[model samples]
Target: MSYLFDHPDKVMPFFWEHVRLTFTSLLIALCIALPLGFVIAKYRKLQAPVTSVLGIIYTIPSMALYAALIPYTGLGKTTAMIGLVAYAQMILVRNVVAAIQGIDPMMIEAAKGMGMSKRQIVFRIEVPLAVPVVLAGIRVATVSIISIGTVAAWIGAGGLGRLIYQGLNHDHTGKIVAGTVTIALLAIGADLLFRIVEKIFSPRTA
Candidate 1:
């Protein structure tokens, strides 16, 4: 409490860094996942292999991944962001594939029967239908990123985790509490935000 109360200037910056890191990683993951998911989902045959590889990547421990990346990317933000992005891939891509694949085949057939081109069908029918499920995946991935972002501080990526590790090193209970509490709140905030979004898109709500 004292650490946070007395050091708002200090703690707040880290809080925002954590936010930035999380958003950046998710954005990157989404950009990559969205297209790749669509491609693999379209082919159908590609889905199993691509997702399997991503699943394996996600299973590796974050620390090991970071350690492996550090050699190539060096320490600091690059290494951290790469690691975060990699960990996020399995969740984002799988969700995207699931989202697109979950759409009713009849809806697609109707779109085609209406003389809709592939581009039109994709943009009009597929994208809208996929958004809610993708949002759910984003909600899950966001929390995962927030949790992983803490470990990122160890690599100098700079986030709330800095306070945590630093506190451990210095035996400062206040720093640990501040970091942990803020992280929990951030995760909760993301979850709720996406939940509202999911509800908005849901047919049930309409």
Candidate 2:
């Protein structure tokens, strides 16, 4: 709309901020989740308890999570990052465990037969084959984080959500539309990008 066009500078910065927050949170989540997931998957006794705990964290309301974090981290990117990472753990951890577990036993055996070390088998054989499913999880987690990250604005973590909140306060329909549209577009674009990356890394289909 003309209003959005007129406010391009104002809108773009907020949109980029939202992207930054979403991506950074996802990256951190991945770092934590991937190793934790692998450890969980490797240990039968720990898997259920760890995953259950993370799932419980995911079910907690976002506002409640932010509020709980505020005493330690205060209102800003730190709190937002904590909330986003917590939410992502459920998805990433589950997916990583499943992906590694779902790998064909024959493939692993073959890799081992080929004189592959344990690390080589895991990194080269198991991980490469699991790329599609792992990336699918990443796609889901990224989209979810982007949607929830908007709530971060309430705590002073600036993003497009801030625009939406401001628009709501001022009854500015145009700004609201701009912010909402930007988020939708971002979610869709990120989903597509991850899907493409998944396909590229995935083994050839017969």
lDDT of 2 by residue, 1-206 (tens): 55568999999999999999999999999999999988888897999899889989999999999999999999999899999999999999999999989988998899889999999998888778777888989999999999999999999999989999999999999989988888898999999999899888777869
Query: What residue pairs clash in candidate 1, if any at all?
Result: none
Q: Give the TM-score comparing model 1 with the true structure, all chains together.
A: 0.96
Q: Relative to the unseen true structure, what is the Cα RMSD of model 1?
A: 1.2
Q: Global lDDT for candidate 2?
A: 0.92
Q: Tell me the lDDT of model 2 at 203.
A: 78
Flag regions of model 1 displaced more than 4 Å: 204-206
lDDT (Cα, 0-100) at 68 in candidate 2: 90
State each candidate's clash count. 0, 0
lDDT of 1: 0.92
Query: Considering only N, C-alpha and C atoms within 3 Å, which residue pairs clash in candidate 2?
Result: none
